[model samples]
Target: MSPVTYADIEAASQRLAGVANRTPVITSRTVNELTKAQVFFKCENFQRTGSFKFRGAYNALAQLSDRQKQQGVLTYSSGNHAQAIALSGKLLGIATTIVMPQDAPAVKLAATRGYGAQVILYDRATTTREKLAQQLASDRQLTIIPPYDHPQIIAGQGTAAKELLEEVPQLDLLLVCCGGGGLLSGCAIATKSQPNQTNSPSHHPRVIGVEPEQADDAKRSFYTKKLQTIHNPDTIADGARTPSLGKYTFPLVLHYVDDMLTVSEAAILRTMFFLWERLKIVVEPTGALAASALLEGLITIPDTKIGIIISGGNVDLQQISQLLK
Candidate 1:
C-alpha cells in the first residue's frame, strides 16, 4: 500500500481551499453536558452536496488534465459520494456516470441526477457495482474516481480534519464513521501533520472508527490484522455499507486509527432521532454512527475534547415515518 503522506494531504487541502466548504466547527453546551466531553461537531452535513465527499471529488477533478476532463469520469457510490462526484463533475464541466444500487436512498439518487450525471441502477442483492463501474470505465474510456481508494480522494477528505484542527487544536479524540475508510484515513493525515495534535509525543488524537455491527469491515480488519472484506453487507447505514476498505486506505487506517468499535442498528436509529430532536440536525443513519457510538458508551469520551463528524444529511424522507415509528 502506498503511503498517504501528510504532504499529499496538505497539497489536497490547498487544492480544495476554494472549492470545498470550510465548514464551521459547531459546539454546544448541551452536548458538553451530556458527554462530559468538549464536543466539537464538524457539520459536513451542511456542506455543499450535503457531505464531505465534495472535498475529495473536487480535489481529484481539479487535478485532471483538460483532455482527461473532457474524456469524463466514472464512479460507484451508495449516495453521498455519487452526488459529490456528479456535482463536482458538472461544476468542472466534465461529464459523469454513476453506478448506484437500485435501492439507494431516493434523495441521493435524485440529487445525483439533478447534478446532470447519467445514472445507472443495479441490483442491490446480486449485481456488483464495482464490476459495472469497471466495465463502463473501459467501454467509455472514462477516468474512474473511486469512492475511497485513491490518494487524491483521501487527501481531499483529510482537509476537513485539517480545517477542524485549525479551529480546535486540542482535540483528544476524533471519532469518525468508517465505510471504505476514506474519511478516517483523511482525518489521520490531517491530525498527524499538526504538532501536539495527539495527547502525547508518540500519540495523536485517538482516531476511533465507528461502524454498525452488521457491516463492520474496518472493525474486523483492525482486529484480524488483515485487510478484510464483507460480501454484500446489508445495513441501514447505506452510506456505511462499503464492501471493504481500500488497499490504499487500509494501511493508513491500520497504522493511524487508534481503535474500531461497532454500534447496533438500534443505536444508530436512536442516535439519529436524538440528533434530530436534541441537536436539531437531520443526520442520516450513517452520519450519526459516530454519535451513536458515543451515546451507547461504546467508547469513553468522558471529559476529553472530542470531534465527531456529522458526515452527511442525505436521508430519504419517505422512509422517515417508518424509521421513526
Candidate 2:
C-alpha cells in the first residue's frame, strides 16, 4: 500500500482548520519535575467528541462524493471512533451506521446513538465487526468508512501531530498510543515529513507507539517486522485492544515509527489516576497508554523534550470510580 504523504497531512490540516479543535498542548510542572523531562501533552481529550478520532472521521466524511454522502456511511468501533463517525455524520447530514461490540461501554454507546446514528451491537467474540459492517454497507449501498485503514482517515489523523509539531517544533521524541497504528503512523508521517524552522538537518523527532501489554499487537509487529494479531485482549485500555494494524497503517508504522512499547495494566491504571489527580484531567485508560509508558520508565530516554498524544477522555464513570477505589 502506498504511504500517506506529507502533502496528504497538509491537506488534512487545511480541511480540519475550523472543523476540528486545535486541542491545547498542556504542560504540568509537577509532571515535568517528576520525569525530569519537558513534557508537552497534546490533549485530544479536549477535542470534539472528546477524542482525536473526530479529525479523521470528519475529514473522511467531508470528502465523500455527493452520491456517496446521499448513500451515507458505515463503520465499526468500540467507542471513540463510533462516536466520532456518528457526530461527524450528524454534522455533515449523512446517515451513519455503526457496528459496535455488544459489551462496548454504555456511555459511548449512548453517546453514539445520541449523535443520531443507527447502532448495531454484535458479540465481539462471535462476530467479526468488519465483515458485518461490510455486508451491511454492501446491502444498503452505504460507504464503508473504516475506523483506521484508509489513507484519508490516516491523513486526517495526522493533523493532530501536524498541529503539535507546528506549535512545538523542537520536540526530541513523540509518543503516541497505538491501537491499529492509525494515530501512530499518521503522527509519525506528520512529524518526520516536515523540517522544523531550525536550520539543523536533524530537526525531526523520533516517534514511538505505546500499547497495553495485554494488547501489544503493534509492539509485536514492530519487533517481528511483520503484522501480528491478538484476539479479545482483556484490558482496561479498551480502545487499544485492536486485533491488528491495517495495511495502510502498518506500512506507515514500519517505515516511519521509531519504536513500539507496552505497559502493564497496573501502569495504565496508575497513570490514569495520576493524570486525573496531578494533571487534573480525565484521561481514559487508552488515552493514558503513552503516559503510562513514560511514567513507568518503559522508555529510558532522558532530559529531552517529549510530546505525548493523549488520545481520548471517554471513560465510564462507574468504572473510573471502581478503579479509583
Pairs of residues clashing in candidate 1: 198-204, 198-205
Off by over 4 Å in 2: 197-201
Candidate 2 structure quality by residue, lDDT tens digits, 194-238: 755455536679899999999988888888988999988888998
TM-score for each model = 0.96, 0.97
Best by TM-score: 2
Off by over 4 Å in 1: 196-200
Cand. 2 TM to true fold: 0.97
lDDT per residue (tens digit) for residues 151-260 in model 1: 99998898888888889888888889999999999998788667545546465677888999999888999999888888878789998899889888888898888899
| Candidate lDDT (C-alpha), each | 0.88, 0.91
